[model samples]
Target: MTDAPFQFFDVEVLRTERLTPAVARVVLGGASVSRMASAGRDQRVKLFLPHPGQREPVLPDTERADWYDAYRELDPAVRGVMRTYTVRELRGEAGELVIDFALHGDEAPAGAAGATAHDTGADVHGDAGTASGPATRWARAAGPGDRISVLAPVQEENGGYDFRPPEGTDWVLLTGDESALPAVAGILESLPPGLPTRVWIEVHDPADRQDLPTKADAEIVWLVHGTSPTTTEAIRAAELPAGTPYAWTAGEAATVKALRRHLVGERGFDRRAVKFSGYWRRGASEDSPMSAADAEEEA
Candidate 1:
């Protein structure tokens, strides 16, 4: 049987707000956005950004037999850059959805020209420079009437680090950088009430931490860089309580990998009980091709 065809939808920015100095929340809306209500939390979708002057992006006809070629033949300028981001929330009432942007420091690359343009002027650095690419620039500038392109959610077989607590596990361990915030938050919000869970998050500062409503008993430890000598390192140094605990970790590729080794290899935690992912790698550009060296090192 043929695989289900991928669906593409066009959307527009309805509003935006700064959640923190480094995080910006963008709400997208349009008739097509209502369909996203079925998307699962933590599911990632590709965002396509139009060129600086274009009002809207033209998506390839995935239905065509030569869709791949057609996609390749599209004008590079209008092709719109792509980025993998999670669906934070989907509201059917206004056909609105939200995604958060981790503003890279001024040294980072500038984003494309759309929803993100207005905020791009700030001198943020890090992956944001190149990571933002075109979609981020467009996202920053995106306003109530701005039009954008969105593809149907692509559910990966093992796309994200799962956080569902294992049966019999009494404790939970959660760790990641700012990029992992959305997924971490989604996991925390979905837990069953009265379950005991402990979360450790590493961020640039204490302010990056946000209160999450959950029925499960949770203890959150926020690790801040600069103030804390070892932000990510502290997570590794932390001693897990005596008991089988479900662990979830994601963040910079190298750091997450280190924690994975410590928990599973050194600490002897069951590999199946832990979920870990590398959201991004330090000093790497989104446009740069992935390399074997990077993979081997992270592994």
Candidate 2:
């Protein structure tokens, strides 16, 4: 499959807001962004940055129709590595878009690379150590007038899984890591009023817990993973209330898989009823985000 020609659009940074110590919200607006505000909440688009002294990158005009497929099919070796991030909120009337980024600390590879670059007084992109790491670095400095190339939105395949609570289902179980929080929050917000839901989120620390606005009857549990994302023991210790009929889990690759197997295979939940996804695999780089196909094969 071949990719469509690139559609170049210019967006201005309208404002930037800090959500937390680690999370930043960037708002962009422009006539070119009108269509994106109507896209789904979880939809993702690629952001291409202009290299030093280069105008915005260009795509062929004819490739626009099949851009998503062509973009995905492009040779990894030739294309600049793209980072996948969520579209947290969109406002068409206001011509606004919001994306959240998790700040990297010293322990994180991105943070460490940034630190090293600062010490050496090197250009951000020239610092090979940081440039070769995760996408977090890009988020740290992203601002308006940055001239980023954006691909059309691509929907997540696993989003079709049944998250709607059944008529008789009295309780819901939601579990995931920070990567899955956006989806979890969306799911909770969509549930019908008075539907009891329990959410368990694994974050790096207590400060990671953000108030999620939801109308559904729910309880939130946060598990901290200081210094690493593999600290799933607290997540494992969670005991769902008796008679939980629905379960949705997403997080690190290995952890989510294990939870799915345990709930469906060992606990005897219907295999078709549980929706689980691995947002990212441990040790996997952002340039190659995990896909549902990979998750299925691994499972």
Candidate 3:
């Protein structure tokens, strides 16, 4: 965690747009998120989507580690779908918070299927399992005026933010599948202008390719599934700059693990300089203890 403690707020949907066939862009608006100090890049926020036909989402009045316990006490039908995601863009002047949701993917398109547990990319569960989850299904049909609850980072320590770049590091390396797009995009925006970098993103659909804006000297590499190297392989193939290059990689659990191993164990990249995480695991749903969000919550 890179920021302060998190606080809960009630927010309404200001608008929704289709970024791609499988991705939905949602803007959550209100004084809570709009007036919030920027949580910074790659910060995490918990979204409590409303139950179908319900006007508001059910949320716990507690905080710290107790909130999870209290939230778990609610009826599943009323609790709705509780998932985590990265803050894509912060619009303080407009009093809005932009979040991209990768719509549900398992039985349909994968990337941008549901608001991913980490980023706005992919969902780990299939439609059969996600059919009842409010986040995915609600995102599929969510419209303006619909409301949800957001647990955003507070100004105190351990507030659920995740960005951490070491001081004096010269260059950067970033890799992830579609599931990490939102975080990666936000990170790119935060980097120092014109810093040399390498970015590798893996996605199944060409439409998932986005025109990510960055002031860094970023070389964008789109690794299309079935054609380009595996996300890990692509990372292994990329050339990092000289003198203490920091790397951050994420996405599917197994692949992220493999990339970490390749960077540290095999390639001799400094262990402390490489930041990686498993965004989601293959063949696992958000309910599984192995899912990324579950692990983070428990941590």
What shift in Å separates residue 135 of candidate 2 from its native position after superposition? 2.5
Best by lDDT: 3
Candidate 2's residue-wise lDDT over 95-117, tens digit each? Answer: 67666654544334323332212
Q: How many angstroms is residue 180 displaced in model 2 relative to the true structure, after the best TM-score fit? A: 1.7
Show the lowest summed lDDT stretch of 10 residues, model 2: 119-128
> Residues 1-299, candidate 3, lDDT per residue (tens digit)?
22335667778899999897656789889876654555567777777777777888876664455768777788877775677677787777888888887655443464433334322232432111222244557777888889888777656245455667789888888887766888899889888898988888887778888988999999999988777788777766766677777888877766777888888987788988887776665444554455555533321
TM-score of 2: 0.72
What TM-score goes with each of the models?
Answer: 0.79, 0.72, 0.85
After superposition, candidate 2 runs with Cα above 4 Å error: 1-12, 37-80, 105-134, 152-169, 226-239, 242-244, 286-292
In candidate 3, stretches whose alpha carbon ends up further than 4 angstroms from where it belongs are 1-4, 62-65, 106-133, 156-158, 291-299
Which window of 10 residues has the lowest lDDT sum in candidate 1? Answer: 117-126
Candidate 2 yields a Cα-based lDDT of 0.54
Q: How well does model 1 score by local distance difference test?
A: 0.61
| Tens digit of per-residue lDDT, candidate 1, span 1-299 | 02433356778877898786567788888876765533343555556667788787666875666764676677766675555566667676778878777655442333221111123321111133233445445555667777766655423343322455667987777876677777778777777786677777766756557776778888778877556645346756666577788888766666667788887877788988977665565444333443323432463
CA shift at 54, candidate 3, in angstroms?
1.9
